[model samples]
Target: MPSRTSRPTRRTALLCAAGLLALPRLQAAPAKKPLPPPPDVWPRPALVPGGVARLSLGPSATRPQAHSGELPLLVVGDAIEWTALVGIALAAPPGEAAITVAAPGEAARRVPYRIVAKKYQEQRLTVSPRTVDLSSEDQARYEREREHLAGVMATFSPAVPAQLHMQVPVPGRRSSSFGLRRIFNGQARNPHSGMDIAAATGTPVRAPLDGRVVDVGDYFFNGGTVWLDHGAGLLSMYCHLSAMDVKPGDQLRAGDAFCKVGATGRVTGPHLHWSVMLNRAMVDPALFIDA
Candidate 1:
């Protein structure tokens, strides 16, 4: 009973109403895209006594995942950087730790890793003619110096603002004896705590990153030692210096000269003993340095 024009008009109105109703769903379909896949998880060996676990993150843009026992895993990501922290779950138990990291867009890459743990040991050293034997007065001086060193280490900050900037403090031949077991005069000693760079006497030492000079002094063991506090609980140390050019509280930039190499500590010849600490844990400086 409807006219042809009226029928066409009614059909057009119906089609327009249906289109209006479907528009919201079409817009929402894009919003319902599936999230990215979770990262891969790996289990680590049990932690050593008085030691914490160390994790090396792969160079990937994807976020990382970490779970602590019954607690939910925390995954944090930023534009191109990602990091995760997993607290020690066991008080003194022997169990493995699992860490998961997301792959970067399905691409394969070789990731390097190094882990260091603290252990207790007794060390002995031979008293060479060059070794400074402390008198009672000198002994007091050494104790005071060590206490100051501990204080400086306590105030260190660990959060690195930029990629870990590092350099060999002195230009010299690296000793293969680094981290070696030593038996001096038929007595065992602790493994070398730092890398030994053999350089000529009075060779200038430089800072590897921006930091604040926290302690500088001569001791019976370390000789002329300098400790730098890089913010975020990170620290760098220069030991056995012939001279300390920087004073405490002074700020330093990368490549800044801080000392001159010398055989001041328990050493055979002139060298710079450079060490790095992260969250009170000593790690291999090679991990942060380019070969």
Candidate 2:
């Protein structure tokens, strides 16, 4: 019953659509996805105890996958040659080793590697009997702390770090070096797992690189400890702190104050125990230092 004008003929409808199109339009363009941060220039890693090995996967048209037994490799590169950074454990015996490399649609290849023996100096220390001979409660507490730390060190993210050259946390003399076979209280203990830097108590400790605080806790050995996750299975630990300035889930940039160095834990004097972890294994921090 409507009029012909209300019903609209094809010509009229076309005219109306033309007018609608002439009016101002409100539409948004599709948002662009953010690109990942640029990868850092690869550092040369040594393949010895407490060292990092930079193993090449050869030139390939695509990225390759590599692993050493249960440990995953951090591979970096593109359509060109790719390399892997392998963290050698201090306890690893020097001998021939191989890493399994696999490319898409290709069989995995176990490339042989050699680990040369490195002599580490020994240090004798006289510490408290309670530290050397742990009580039942102390042993239980250490085990619990150890479990918690293992979880922190096991963090693996696909994000590649923006930088590898690290800044010195707190300026101090490198006192107790890494991998020192220490005879403590006449009993042999595990080789030094981290570097001991002699710094004054209450001295501010900064983050060596960009990272997120994954853990902050107190322990029998590493008192007032803090763990930073630097993406791609790279972790850094700051132990024996006098005070912690950051907490879990906090973001930190390179040289940002994180805590204060202290002699807390099982140390004789004030120092910072700096440990660099790659693929859950503690490796040498010296490898990151720029020459």
Candidate 3:
């Protein structure tokens, strides 16, 4: 029997404490992780063809490298959180798509995302029969230009542009929207890959963002074209210009007039055709501009 007022012996107390330790203990549920805030910038996420997808890659000590297929993607942000801006091709099928992320000292992993379908409007126009049915000489010239433009489009510099939003180059009514299919003289042609702005022949065309002139040429189809490399995998093209003020390797700031509107190429009238390319994909330029 134990006395009510007597203290337990040291050995008994120790044994009791040990027994208590052996019993199951309750733990507070792990604190819920806070959700990340939405990105407050241009080029908002649109998980569809011809759209830009913003993928969040968890924190890393160094900038992680990401790629969509073989082409490297543009990864931005700091050590706390990095994000990959993936440009979905207009021809990309609506289904599961993934990008490869490689962080320093870690095995590369695949980050998967989904692409939904989108439909664009169709347009038909009447142009010269000769423009639709090209001559042999003109066809050869077009092939050469196409091959050269492919190399220009593949330009990728190390520095990424600080600003993503672009200003309208030539302020006017939007003549044609992007991804518009066209029927020229009853012959089906490729979908319009750019946003066309209706302006006068001498209307000054300005740079939408800071970039370096990569290629300046008078293409058969594009005409007095100027390609600006905006660093990383982003590039912009201004076509059908009456005059080009900037040459290759020239640096241009936003709002600087680099060319003038014209009907130099195969067109019905004077207009500026602006195209934005990312990761070798011609995405909708409207994505990088304000409505």
Candidate 4:
């Protein structure tokens, strides 16, 4: 008997060749790109009517411009990334909605987003007939005010707000909520566009964020109202105030007392009607503030 030389079988050689063939494929495979971070939590994204939609614009060397139809949107973030904060109208029908985004040096493109339907509660109340059925003079005044407010709401300034999170303007009970289909007596009216905080008359109403007083006046319905421009298309309104401490062009820091609560407007009692408007749409103020 002689010692047989050890040799690889055909099957062994094929297995070795297969292993060699797999090495380059494993080595040449590229690493997967990382996902982006989530958007800011403030003005929490709610894809419904009377909600704020936070649409990520990805990264860019400069801030991109966005718009809802003809109305410009508030695009915030740095050169590395940008986001569009759009205010969904309370009357917005649920379905597909799109916004136009135009990055620097690039052609504008439309980005479609989905909007879920939301049903708000209806409220019935009994008030003076005079408030509900306006006189001819009051009607004319309201029309004028509406025209003026249209301009105010259309304001889209260059400055972006420092922070999206907001503090409550006053400490009190939430007497009324936004998006309520209010009915006075037996007649129906538009949905309540703001949050009403119940407080004693003369209670200080402070600014929730840094803003410039853009409009202050005694309106026909709102009484003593103050509008604060928080830069970009972000504006906050304080309505039914007894007194206004800040005037147009007056700059105010967060927590600065800008007005006092009152029952001056078409209200049953003293309360602060706080509203947050973005891109001319009156969104639910509760979205920006903690309830």
Shift of residue 123 alpha carbon in model 4, Å = 1.0
Model 1's TM-score against the true structure: 0.59
- Superposition error at 218 for model 3 (Å): 0.7
Candidate 2 TM-score over all chains jointly: 0.83
Off by over 4 Å in 3: 1-39
- Residue 194, model 3, lDDT: 90
Model 1 spans > 4 angstroms off: 1-81, 84-142, 176-178
Model 4 misplacement above 4 A:
1-40
**159-233 in candidate 2: lDDT tens per residue?**
778878888888889998888999998998888988888989999999999999999998999889999998888
Which 10-residue window of candidate 4 scores lowest in summed lDDT? 1-10
Instruction: Tell me the lDDT of model 1 at 18.
Output: 93
Regions of candidate 2 where Cα sits further than 4 Å from its true position: 1-42
Give per-residue CA lDDT, model 1, range 51-103, as digits (tens): 23445554455454433333322233464654443323212234444554446
Model 4 lDDT tens row, 1-291: 533433456667888999898786546668888989876578888999999998999899988989899988888877777889999999999999999999879999988899999999999988788889999998998999999988888777899898989999999999999999999999999999999999999999999999999999998778899999998899999999999987799999999998999999699889999999999899998888765
lDDT of each: 0.62, 0.87, 0.92, 0.90
Q: Estimate each model's TM-score.
A: 0.59, 0.83, 0.86, 0.85
Error of 4 at 1 (Å): 36
